[model samples]
Target: MTDYDVIIVGAGGAGLAAASAASENGASVLIVEAAARAGGSTALSGGVFYAAGTSLQREAGIEGDAPDAVFQYYMTLNQYKLEASLVRKLCDDSPAAFEWLRSIGVEFRAEDLYMSGVDKVRRGHRAAGGGAAIAEALEGSFAGRSVDVALETRVETLLIEEGRICGVIVDGQPVRSSATIITTGGFGANPAMLAQLYPDAAIHGDQHWYIGAPTCRGDGILMAQAAGGQISAANRGLLLLTPGFAKELESYVPGWLMMVNREGRRFVDESIEYSVMAAVLGEQEDRIAFGIFDEASRMASKTTSYRPAPNWTADRLDEFVAAGTLEKADSIAGLAERIGISPDVLHTTVNRYNDHVSDKADGGFFKPASFLRPITSPPFYAARICAAIICWTGTGLRIDTRAQVLDAADRPIPGLYAAGETTGGMFGECYASGGASIGNAIIFGLTAGREAAALARLHAPLAATS
Candidate 1:
């Protein structure tokens, strides 16, 4: 009755990689995806792969970059809030996983390598054609293989025989399999799941938006949970800071703009990384902050630079003011009154920052003198910024390093495995890096496929007898 040795739900980067890997190991594999095409949210991404101790690093003239370094940095970044065992395994096997992708025709250029997340060492490997290219490469990897893809098909139910997951129910029919892997992507497109799990983004209301594909309905998590899988209990995900003035993403606040908390006090350097910056904003009053800048700074922001603000242009500022999204006043106290803050505190904060500008230094947060500019001109403006852009959700089914979906009691759900965004335990309070999502998908997808294949091999005799 077993139709395939392994059945993978969702054909994103993880599902495709899993199908190819399982097929390569002499296991019959079938990839079922709901989308018209195979690529999932990963195809809509920038296509960066985060790894350590790879030939790409060596070819780029960087040496001594290893998994040990990644572990140290990741642990410190998340304060060890994540499962240490899983992170350690991910770091250890990252290089091998990356090489496997390359062998499958995914092109990564040494020149495109750059520093991402909080890593002092460079680990972001940019694909030649961005995320679409990586998706194409992963899809192309199916060549000359026994991997079958069922596109535009949603997995209606996870069919469990007895206490073990055996296969799935699609279109009212039971498709038996030795093992099932969930890689159906995240719940970003699911508003109900967003409000329940990611309250931080939910608070943004209309400002919030997810960059992933709309097909990410979180069906995998729900289906797995129905099969006794434990869902992750946390409100964690990657969010980008934005003016909420427009839908376009604004990752970094220009250093020239001064940021103030609810009490009109400066808290952090404006030029910090988005993941780190968003975390700091959550600590502020009401999880809100304001970007304070003048006409000069707003006008100068239009000049092409590494951190260009397409939403912060002079015209946009005027539009925001005209639309009342941005508050403006000739005096600092007046601006404070409009924004509902103490006039005296606003006045003092501005004066202190102006003093630092005059001294050509950032005595408060040391935000680099080059980016420090005094905002003394009339008609000062302040725009509300929030961590609204939902890049990836962190809440999903919990899994071990072996990619087995665990139950509420921390026991593995037999015949079930998961990888990619559908599974949690990879991310913590902070998103590890730019390429962590894709890297996680391909890496653990590779693991899940092999593990499921090994399981199928073990179950062959029992299936035949039954």
Candidate 2:
């Protein structure tokens, strides 16, 4: 058995952050990852960290914001589904988190425009090249450190003794440690698990594309549950929309297109924020939605303001059309007929939209004119887009503010610590603005590591005194 001060399962953002913090505090740390890589979902993310009143904003000559204002924006948008305490913590600690990242050589640049359709004050921050940049910076900080990163190693279960977590079992062997941090992400990639957690969402085939790594199989959650930790709000997960056909690769390809539902009607103003779009996408049956566009829409995408996915391009769109993966028609009616929808319904939908544009009224749909580009152009295009569930489910082992996994009775499971998605329901019912996941993971991981290290230190002294 290999002994260490701390053992962290899952080498994603949270685990890596925990390892760094523990090592910095003079504690030996081991990070065991199932995949060969360390980045995990953070590498696959958009790398935007939303923080109001950040030091970066102040340095850039932008006016600082109040925490109350930040809290108000999130609460208003999320409709108070989120826990007040956790939301308040996020707003309060985000600035410090941003400063911490910068201290570790991570740099961020402000976005030129707010993400269309989400209501918020300007506070979007992105690392260069998105997530990879942040991951690289984190990797740099661990060079030649006492932190041990073991890749391609799967943690089978938690090793508990006398009601306290002693370590973990990995690959049929026991790795002993004084403390363990479970950062293994959500169960979005596991079809069986998704079916169990959300039966109604599984009906539509290929509705969600697992944008995160396939290794996020909920190992930590399973282990923690077996050890008497409680899980809360297992049904809440973030829903995202990707371009049609990209589901085959299980990747997101965002572009300038209009989204519609089964009734051939637009449900949201595409120009609005992404969270609003995500919420709208979640409401549809099987979380499946469609993207309708035309040749003009494709052309306009050349300079489209928001491009979240790299794989989305005009060439790819043309290829999808040629391969019969995407449908194209000379008219909206023809396009609707090909996609197995009512032509009259689509036609009337388009006419009403056009009338809205002419009359300067929202026409009951409340779609913003910015996204209301008439779908009347020639060579109409349509693709079946659905909610691409990036497997960061919000359910996991319940933990307190200190990131200690608690039992069903709300008592801390001794020596058992959890961070990231494994410490579920940290964000409560609503996922706040960007970087909330990564932020929580890092902050809680640090807390767990330091707290565990202190406990381990106390054990030897107590034994000596005895």
Candidate 3:
């Protein structure tokens, strides 16, 4: 007899969502998580989700917001490098995903926030208490339902028979099932895996760190690869770069500060999206840069732009300086010396930037007038910044729109489904700023759960062999 109708590996947001959906659809489901807890990186997240054509937006009185508009915006960010079919599926099913989250008891605030690079109306919904709240809601729902959750059970291998995935081997015991879904998160915490995929981290060597879950070791990717799944976009992933000593992900550099390369030269509009800023930093020499600002700019950061949690207050800045994470000086030349850059070049760069600020225009990079601030007031401050990978691993097992793991020939691996960060091709060359990550997890995870359950009910259990 089949152990369960659907066996979901990894009890993160995706796995829990899948288990709930599958069990609600009249299929037996089991969730196996490597960690003792259910929430993975999802719990640590800000609990934002992006979906277009949602009732939430309608209730918030946001008008003229259409799915097509959302689709175009996502495509534009990645320059259409993402598979159109997959993007189309996500756009078409986004509204339902929003409804699904609410059905699972995840509460979203009525207010919406504008995520950077989203050109249209506000579609980003924040969960009532961030990702932990969302995770707890889902976990509670799954627990109350008929599904079974097994914590601290690591799937060492995918058990395949007759060229079909049957179930998984946990604790050296084969647990057979009709279908299996891999919801394991990305490999950001695994430095060896990251260095192999990310070029900057590879070439520079030891200059990068990650802020994702300690349990995210790319388990699902490796398992699926061994099961004949194709991994794609290994070099592409999300990066969050900032000047700080904390290994955690929070980075709060004010936009008004001028970002300079190692030669003490300005590059890129400082007001650009943080993800793009991280990518630009990767392109610089040694994958390093610095954020330069004066006393006034430093003080201004405490009130404006630097927001929410982990804020950059004056005290925070002082703490960073005291901790040696931020370099400070009373003059621009002295600041350059402290940060180990040429004082003359730093002076020239700041003077030109000051002229641009006076004109309220950045002629070099076209930074917005609102972000232009003169670096006239001293003591000056500089922070040595480096690029670090956040949650997105970029590399994952390829899957079709139905969330079925695909082979190198683009054929579906029957009885095998995948979702969330474990599955690939949802994102492309660039990542959308808002809740795309968690949004994709909910959308595809639910879809995979539904599909796996249906497939399981369609087939009889394999005859027992001893």
Candidate 4:
């Protein structure tokens, strides 16, 4: 059995950040990761941090906004669905979190990316090389430290002593520690959990691909529950429906088109908030929509401004169409016929949208005209954009401002702490602007490490156990 001051699970952005901080604070730390690589979903992310009114913003000549305003924005957007305490902490600590990353040698460029769907102020900080670069920087900081990283190791269960979490069981061996942090990411990739939590969505055969790591299997949630922690309301978890073919899998393949409903009618405006599209898709009985576009729309997708990924191109679109994965037609009526919808209904919907776009008014659907390009060009194209889900669960553990995990009774689980996606109840119900996950992970991970080290120094020698 290996003994340490602290044992951190999931070596993603949060775990790495915690290890670095704890080691700097003079505590022996052990980081165990299931994957061979260090970075979890953070490495696969776009590397944007959604922080407001930070020194980075001021340095970049951006204005300093109030944390209260950020909190209010969150409340308004989420319709007061999130917990007030957690939301307040996220907003209050966000600026400091941004600065902490900079102090650790992770550089942030001044360019700000905006999510127009949220329609809020632009406050996203992009890291160089995206998520991978941030991970590399953190990994570099851990060189030659007392912090030991064990990769390809899975933590099987929490070792409890007298009703308190004392350590964890890894690979069938008991590794003891004063504390354990559960930063195991979200349960978006867990199909079983998804089926249980979202029965309505499961019936439609909805699936998810983007927004979470494949290893995020609700391990932390399950372990905590088994150890007597209670689960929160499972009412949250959003869907990501992209324009593609096949039920719930079209987002993976190529198809540049607009999204529509089962009536072969274009419903919500395509170019708006992803949350809105997700909400709309979740309500649909079919849970499968069509992406109606033309050759010109496909060609436009190749431009840097519109292209989300390099692989999304007209060539890929043609290949999918040739493969019978996409339905191509010379007219809207023809496209509707192929998709087994009434051509008159599809035609009327498109005609109404064209008039709205031409008149610069979205009377039927309030989506901005900037996102409302007429779908009149030919040869018309349509693909099934399956409703995919990306659920966020098992976030910031019930720790204090210092990021330590709290026990079932709301007391600190000594020496143990968590950060990032593993820290449950941090973001509450609303996922604020982009970068909330990474930013919170970095901030709280550092806090947990520093606090745990300080606490370890003051504590008496560990009690002997079998």
Candidate 5:
């Protein structure tokens, strides 16, 4: 006889979500997490939930946002390289997923709804207390549910019989079950996976680093691959730009800081979302850009909230310059020469930027007036920036709209399901939105749980398996 009806590998947002849905569907659940903690990368995230038609949107007076609109925007932004049916399922179930997380004690404030991507829609719902709160809520759910959590216990392998998954090999022992859901997170921490899956970010060597949980070692993806599941295309995760001024996570560059490409020309609005900024920067020469700002801007900068500008504060700037991390010069031309750009083009770019400073309008990029600042003060500074920060790897096992793991032939592997970062094909080229990953985790985790539960109900619990 089987020990449980459904076995969930990893205890991240997706795994916990799967267990939640499976238990509600009358399946006995077992959650195995490799780390001492339960949340995985979800707990370390910003806790934003990217969703449309959410109750928070209406409460915040944001209208004209629906699942279909979200679907179109996502498909358009990614250039339609994603799996349409799966994307549709994610879009349609996002609102319900939002409500479900709320029902489980996670908080999403209406006022916290903000624009999190290239789209103007305010669909990013920032949960109170960030990802830690959402992770806590999901883990706390174990108190009332029929879930057995095995911490610091990694799944050795997916146990298969008759070409179907039956359970798992945990700690060299067999744990029999009717169905298994793989929710293990990404592989940003693994150097082999980084070089193999994400070459762009891997080129930076030691300069590159991951922002997710250290336990995100791609355990679930590897197991699925060994079980004959397919791996999606590589280089698909969100990569953030950084100046290498210490590994401190800097998501947004200060609006006051101007960026110039190799030709010493401005390319982006400088204040756009990180995903868009990274994508745009990736197209730049050598996928590199430089942040230009004056001494005054750095001195006047404060630690910002809506967008973090901690690295630009006067003290931090001075520290960086002293450490040779930031190049300093008494004039703009001198700064351009140091950064290896044409001084003439840099002069023209600065002249036009200064001309509009009084009007508080960026006529070229149309940057918001509130963030505009003239780089007129003496002693200009520049820092090298590249989109090298690996947020969460996008290469993983392939799954369908129903969260069922698919083999090389795109056929579903019975009793095998996957969700969250463990499953690939959710993201296309760029990360669609801020909360897209978390939303994917919760929505597909819920789906995988229910699907595995149904599959388990039909089976006699892996009866008499050799």
Candidate 6:
């Protein structure tokens, strides 16, 4: 006997959304998660939704910003790499998705915020409680609903019948279903998968670290591949600049700090987005960079992005200094010597930068005058900044706009669907924004669930006869 009409794998944002949609469509649903809890990397996120045409948008008093504009913005960012149909689905349906979440107990505020890669619209709607709140709302949505969820149940393999995905095997037991959906998230926690998929990142040896949920080990991707689903851009991920040892620093690097490669020279505008920063760091020697700042810069600047590190009090900065993560020196030469770079080159770099700051101009990188603070204060600092994985893996099975898992030939494998990070082709070489990732997860997760449930209903008679 079939276990359910729809069997959704992984209980993250995508899986929960899928399960809820399936249940609403009159299909019996069961969500099997490998982790002990429902929230995957979604719980670790900022819980912002990139949506257009929302009531919040109207309330914010921004006029003439339509969904089409949002769609155009993403198209420009992705450079037509992502499927236009899927992108349209996300952009057009996002407002309804945001409202649906509200209908399901998810709370969001109408705050106009501009995120990285989003140039025109301020559509980032922040969840009232961040990622955890969104996760809690989705998890709570399943209560009293016609859905069964299994936590800590590792799906070992897909149960294929004559090349069609019918269900999954977990702990040597098979639970047959009319339709199966994969929402297992990305592979940030799996070092082996990381080395295999992103070998370039592996070149860092011991320096690379992932800052996502440990449960995100790419189980759905592996199972999808084993079941003959085609993989898309498995090598790409959302990488951030950080002082590797301290995971908390992943959010915001002070703009006043100059980021230098191993050769001891600034490579990019210190005020650039994290995705652009990561790409620049990848080209540097050893894939490593350092955030160079002085006492004045530190005292004057506040954390601009990541909330956890926005206000670095003296005590917190001192703690990092005492821990040696943030190196200190009385002179530019001393700072260079501490970080093992050429003192003369470091001095020249500082001198040139100080000259630019004095002129209120960034000749090379064009950083705005507001962020160009001179690094002349005594006791300069250079903190090692490396790329940290933020769990938005640019990888996994190929899916069409309907969220059907496609084979090598781009043909949909019947009864199989995918959503969230497990389904690739949305993100390419760069992460658009935090809101984009989470919003796509919810939109596609809902699509996959409804489509899979419809498929289950269409095949129920055939399944019963068989």
Clashing pairs in 3: none
lDDT string for model 3 (256-289, tens) is 7799999999988877766466666766887788
lDDT (CA) per prediction: 0.87, 0.71, 0.80, 0.69, 0.89, 0.81
Give the alpha carbon lDDT tens digit for every residue of 1-466 in model 5.
7889999999889998899899999888999988898998999999999999988898998877899999999899989999889899999999999998899899989888899988988999999999999999987765777889999888899999899898999778899999999999889889898889878769878889999988888878889999999998888788888999988887877766788999999998988888777789988998889989898887898886878867778998899999999999999889998999999999999899887788888899998888788889989989899888889888888898889999999999988999999888878777898999999999999999999989888885346463
In TM-score terms, which candidate is top? 5
Worst 10 residues of 5 by lDDT: 457-466
lDDT of 2 by residue, 37-84 (tens): 998888887676677777767666678575678778777766776656
Question: Model 4, stretches more than 4 Å misplaced?
Answer: 112-117, 198-207, 245-258, 303-312, 360-363, 366-370, 389-416, 426-430, 461-466
Preferred candidate (lDDT higher): 5 or 6: 5
TM-score of each: 0.95, 0.88, 0.92, 0.87, 0.97, 0.92
Predict model 2's lDDT versus the native.
Answer: 0.71
RMSD of 3: 2.6
lDDT of 2 at 39: 85
Better of 3 and 5 by TM-score: 5
Pairs in clash, predicted candidate 5: none
Report the C-alpha lDDT of model 4 over 30-118, residue by residue, as the tens digit.
88888888988888876877777877667677685757878888777777766567667778878887787777788876664454236
lDDT of 4 at 281: 68
Better of 2 and 5 by lDDT: 5
Model 6 stretches astray by more than 4 angstroms: 116-120, 299-307, 310-313, 340-344, 360-364, 464-466
1 or 5: which has the higher lDDT? 5
Q: Between candidates 5 and 6, which one is better according to TM-score? A: 5
Per-residue alpha-carbon lDDT of model 1 for 273-385, expressed as tens digits?
67578888889998888889877777666734466677777887899888878888888888898888899998899999999999998999988888898798787899887
Superposed by TM-score, candidate 1 places the C-alpha of residue 260 at a distance from the truth, in angstroms, of: 0.7
Residue 208 alpha-carbon offset, candidate 4, angstroms: 3.5
